[model samples]
Each structure stands twice: as C-alpha cells, then as structure tokens.
Target: MYLNSIQLQDPNHYMQIAQSSLLPMLKGALYYTLPLTLITFSIGLILALLTALAKISSIKPLQWIARFYVSIIRGTPLLVQLYIIFYGLPSIHITINPFPAAVIGFSLNVGAYASEIIRAAILSIPKGQWEAGYSINMNYSQILRRIILPQAVRVSIPPLSNTFISLVKDTSLASLILVTEMFRKAQEIAATTYEFLLLYSEAALIYWIICFILSIIQQKLEGRFDKYVSH
Candidate 1:
C-alpha cells in the first residue's frame, strides 16, 4: 500500500521543482563542462606538438622518453588515471581538488593520444618538402617551423577537434571525484526528487545540446581546413 500510496501532494510540484533546482543544475553543468573541455584541450594540444617533435627527433633519449610516455598513458584507462590523481595523490601527501585533478588527468591522457596523431600527420608530409628546406640551407628547427608544422597542423585539426569533443563527454567522469558537472548534478537531483528518469533524461538532453553545438563548430573548422587540402 505504501508503494501505491506515493503521490504528488501538489500534483504540479515538479513544475515548482523545475524552477528551483533543475535550472541551476543545468547552469552549473555548463560552467564546468565547457571550461573543462577548452582548458584540457588547449593544454593537451601544446603538449602533443612538443611530444610529437621529440618522438621524431634523432636524439635517442628524447625518442625513448616520448615512446615511454605514450606507452604508459595509452596503456591505462582514463578512469584509473583520474583515481590516481584524486585518490593516489594523498598517499604521498600531495592533494588537489577534484577540478584540478580532473584537468591534469584529462589533459595528460589526451596529450598522449594526440601526440600519436600529430606524429602521424607530421610524418605524412612529403620528404621532398624537407629536402627543399634543406636545399634552402634551413636547419631542422627552421624546416619544421616553416615548412612542415603548418601543413601538419592543417591535417591534425579534424582529429584534434574530434578528440576534444570526446573529452567534453568524458568530463562527466569528474563526478566520481565530486566535481559537480552534469552527471553529478543529475544524480543529486534524482536523489532529492526520486524522479530519476526525468532528472537524468533532462541532464542527458543538455549534454546532447552542448555536443551538438560543438559538432557545428567542428564542421565549420573542418570545412575551413578542407578548402586548403582540396585539389
């Protein structure tokens, strides 16, 4: 009888509920998720470019270190990576809040993956371009900066943007460490209202909307870059 006895006393309380917490939760989610995606992606991009250069360098130590970093980061799951940042840090007495931990972890993981993409793009450049740079008496760094990297960046943009888009969705994993992003907000709302379906569905809808906008941005960026590549 208790199960059947459950009912909305006001019958329209959810309309009231929507006004009170739901709107704020959506706003909180956006504030965290967008910044998380942008900051992590920017950090990861700079790191990837540097690491990819090291990977291709003739310097043995740099090549080895680059290989090692990529192997270790790629071998682990990002969830475990986050746990190491949030939980493992305290064992050595180093501590950070959930947001910074998530940023560091996500950026490092994305950096490792993006390094491979960058390395591949750079390598795809024709050998003749480097030869032409050498013929012009250009040093390795000059050749890379002037002739190779710009083309590689154009090739890399599509994949890098896609990686960042994936990172946006991944930010929800921050909830495990108590970062109050979208999924965490949904869980909180569900707990308070016992309307798990409605609350979570609304949260999912918000995420989809954000991702849809990012998709539009991605399409425009790809189109812009594609114009240069088209024969």
Candidate 2:
C-alpha cells in the first residue's frame, strides 16, 4: 500500500487521495469535534460562572478553592491534564473512557481560563451599580441576576468568544487520548496510506474553515451585544 500510494504521489493523484479522505475526516468533525466542543464549552461556562462568583465572594474558603482550581489548571499543560484524567486516574480505580475524559479535561481547562475573564468583567462594574440596585431595594441575588449578569455578559463577550474559538481548535487534542475526532481520522488515513503531508494538510484546512466560520459568528454576536449597550 505504501509503495502504491508513493507511486501516485503526483499533484493530481495526491489531491485525489486527499479529496477522498475529506469526507471521513469531516464526518469525524461533525460527530466528535463539534459535539465535544459544544458539550465541553457549555459545562465549562457554567463552571466559569461559578468559579468567578466564588472568587469574588466575601467568603474566604470559596475564594481559596476558586483560586486553587484556577491556579492548578492554568499552571499545567492541557495534554497533561487530559492524561491525568484518562490515564492516571485509574491508579485509584477511577477510570473514564476517552470521550468523557476529554470532555472533563477540556472543561476544566476552559473553566479556569474563562473564570478569570468572567471575574474581570464582573469586577469591572462600578460600585455605584451595586449601590444603585440596593437603593432600589434589590437584594444581591436579584441585582446580580437582573443587572450585573446582563451587563457583564456584554463585557465578557469578546474574550469568552475567543476562549470558545480556542476550545474548538483544542478539541483536536482529544484525538491523542483515543477519541476519534478529525485529527485522529487524518492520522489513521495517513498511517494506512503513508500520506502524512496531504492528509495532515487536509485536516488543517478543515480546522481553518471551522475557525473562520466561528470568527464571523463572533463578530456578529459582538455587534448584536453592542446594540444592547447602545440603547
């Protein structure tokens, strides 16, 4: 197979092999990449919100826990984190499958980074806003729900969108843990046919296309959020 593929390594034939590989690679994205990103981001955002709030809370223990979590996650490499979850945990008999492990690892990684973004956005609000809400008889929860979160969301949009875009790209790392995402599919095809360059380039192109579409959506969302501020 290697010799056969090498014999056809001319431009036209190379492209044909890559083109044939495209559909499977793309299907991997649809099934694994997109779903992993969406699920991980959704969970991560929730974790971020909680961690951000805990960091800002007056309670000392919550603050410490939040800080520690952010510190550990941010200080480590994501690949190592994934390894701990997928490979290292079984030392204590806590084992997880690859997809779940990837989800958990990516969520923690995104959560830690996103928490700082959210915390900064929340802190950027003036003290006067809290006072104003209090003057109107609003409790902290009510004010946070009605006033603070809405405004903070606008401020958080750009960075949070950026984190999400990064997450989309980072999902490729899931393939390392045995999740059959697009990059993994490319690797499999390349291994069998010994067409590493073409297959890898094709995979990169697909990732670029996905990220490009995400950037466009980010801009539109930012514009829409801006309208709310304008009024």
Candidate 3:
C-alpha cells in the first residue's frame, strides 16, 4: 500500500499528493512555528541579558555561577537537555506540562548562547567609555544603562538577529517533546500516508522559506543600523 496503484501507474500522481499535503503543513507552520519562535525568543532574550551581565559582573560569585551555567548548557546536546527537563523533571516532584517544558529548555539553551554574543558586544566597547562615565561621577549601573548598553545593543543587533534565525530552526526540536510543531505535523502525515521523504522534504522546504524571509528582514535591519551609526 506504500505505493499507491494509481501513483505507480502514473508517477505524476505523487506530485498531486505532495501538493495536496503541502497546504496543511503550511497551516501547521503558521499556528505553531511563529508562536513558538516568538515566545521562546522573547523569554530567552531576557535570560540572556541577565546572564551576560552576571558573566561580566565584578562580583566573583556571580561570575563563577554564570560561567558554570553557560558551560553546562553549551556543553550538552539540546535533545538531551529537553529530555532532562521534560522526562527527567518528574522524578523530582517537579512536573510541568510539555509546552512549558519545551519553552523552558529552549529558552535556557538560547540564553547560554546569546549571553556570549551579548557579552562579546559589551566587551568590544572602548574602555575609555567606562572611564569617562566614572569620571563624570556616574555609577556602574548608570554607566551601563545610559552609556555602555545603548552602544552595545547597536553592535549586538546583527549577531542577535542571527541567533533568532537559528532559534526558528531549533524550535523543530520541540516536536520530539510533543509540542505539535510543524515538524510534528509532518511526521503524523507521513505516518498515515507512508510518504516519509516527500513530507519531510516539504517540511524542510517550509523551514527554509521561513528562514529566508527572516534573513531578508535581518538585512534591512542591518542596513538601517548601519545608516544610523554612520550618522
């Protein structure tokens, strides 16, 4: 039954089946793909900012803790991390629903990676800027908020945007955790129709198109930022 008699008789029928299946898969992307990316990226950005600040803090304990956190997250495979959160957490009487578990796992992973990008951006600023703030009798917090971070954000935009583009792809991993994302829908369809390659390739194509559009937006943002910096 894997080979439909009709499709076998006329191979062009395979194209028809592929086209028919594509719309539903696209709808799956609209419902789950964008929402997952937006929520995960939003929460992840906050965590990344806090973690980056802790990494750069003068307090030794904070620096050590942040380093430990980033190392643990970055060293492990993301799938293993998802399993630890979703499947392992129940052992400790910490039970969370699957959606939240996926979000938490993805956010933590993104935080670790994005924190490094932000920290590097912060470091790239001239040391003289910090000294000037101190010379003006401004505190570290004031200098960071008013002087350092503002400039660093402009520099961070390109890398941070790339991180987000990557996050959009990573959300497919959520399907393994039972989040019903686009890839999950494709798997379900493939199981029923026994057309794994076609459905999976369609899913990949959709992901590619989504990322391509995001890359365009990223270029526009970079152009505007470049103009602003040049001014």
Candidate 4:
C-alpha cells in the first residue's frame, strides 16, 4: 500500500513536470524546429531543382559539378556535415552561427537526395511529350516549364513530402550545436529535473505528433495533386 501510494505520487510529480515543461518545449518547437525545417527545405528545394536541371542538361561541366556536389553530400553523414560547418570551419577562420550552420548542413543534405528524386521524375516523363512540345514550336524552356515540370512535380510530391517530414525530425540534431530547438528544451528540462525518461518521452511524443500531422497533410496534398493530374 505504501509502495502503491509512492507510485501514485510519482506520477503526479511527473505530470506536474510535464505540465510545466510543455509550454517552453512547445515554444522551442514553434520558434526553432518549424522555422528551420521550412527555411532549409525551401532553400534545398531550389538547390535540388537546379541540380536536377544540371544533371539532365547537355553541358558536361554542369553535369560534373552537379554530380560532385550530390556525391559529396550523399556520401557523408549529415551529422558530420553539421560538425564541419559548425566546428571544422572555424579552423579556417570561417565561422557561422549555430542556426546558419544547421541551415547550410541540412539544406545541402536535402538538396543532394531530393535532386535525385527530381531528376528521376523529370526523366520519367514520356519523350513523346517533349516531341509534342517541339512540334508545337515550343522552345526547350517552354517544353520543360509547361509540359515536363508539371508532370515531374506531381510524381515528386510523395518523396519530397517524405523528405520534408524527415527534415522536421532532423532538426533535433541542431541541439548538438546548441541551437535550442525542441529536443534541446527537453534536454535542458531533463538536466534540471533529473527526469530523463519522462522528459525525453514527452519530447518524443511532441515529435511524433508533429510528424503525424505532417503525414496527414502529405496524404491530403498527394490526393489533391493526384486529382489534378487525373484531370
């Protein structure tokens, strides 16, 4: 009976801790995690589009440069990339703040992986479509902008959405560089409270909730795009 009462009290204590920490952690997520994901993914998507175009372009140098960039980014672990930007660059007297460093690392990583998806989507468009565009006296740019990219975007949606979701989780890595994101908030709270399991679980729940919401949004977007494509 005494042990049971102690267990009940412990839960109440943890509950209070959760209630207290939830707001600050949520603030961290809102202020840092979401912003990092949006900024990096937006920048990365542009880089990916350019890289994809370069990969398919006739210019040998452009293809080579794009391939090299993709190889370097894909070959290295993202954590190492973050370390290089945040830690190693200081050795060369080039320093970036924690947020910018995370942005560069995550953007480069996303660009490499997403470029492949974009390139494949672009390539998957039937050659006949391009021929039709040319038959209509459309220039290469017109063909791509009007015929190719629209189709490619439809095909790329799922994979790119997955990448965006992954980026949200990856933003937790920013904590290692002292970026004070959601997971960092949990860590700080845990350190003070010495409640590692409870705090970390709460943080994990928050991340899962964010990802779950994103997954639903992805499904909705995919359905909307599919409907558009079918028409």
lDDT (C-alpha, whole model) for all candidates: 0.87, 0.95, 0.89, 0.96
Model 2: how far residue 53 lies from native, Å: 0.5
Residue-by-residue lDDT tens digits, candidate 1, 175-222: 898888878877887898897777777777878887899899989988
lDDT of 4 by residue, 1-231 (tens): 777676444678988999999999999999999999999999999999999999999999999999999999999989999999999999999999999999999999999999999999999999999999999899999999999999999999999999999999999999999899999999999999999999999999999999999999999999999899788
- lDDT per residue for candidate 3 within 67-86, as digits (tens), equals 99999999999999999999
What value does the lDDT take at residue 52 in candidate 3? 94
Q: Sort by lDDT, best first: what order?
A: 4, 2, 3, 1
Model 1: runs farther than 4 Å from truth?
1-19
Superior candidate under TM-score, 3 versus 4 = 4
Better of 1 and 4 by TM-score: 4
Could you tell me which 10 consecutive residues in candidate 1 have the lowest summed lDDT? 11-20
Clashes of 2: 0
Runs with alpha carbons beyond 4 Å of true place in candidate 2: 1-8
Best by lDDT: 4
Candidate 1 global TM-score:
0.90
Model 2 score (lDDT): 0.95
In candidate 3 the C-alpha lDDT for residue 10 amounts to 58
Would you estimate the TM-scores of all the predictions? 0.90, 0.95, 0.92, 0.95
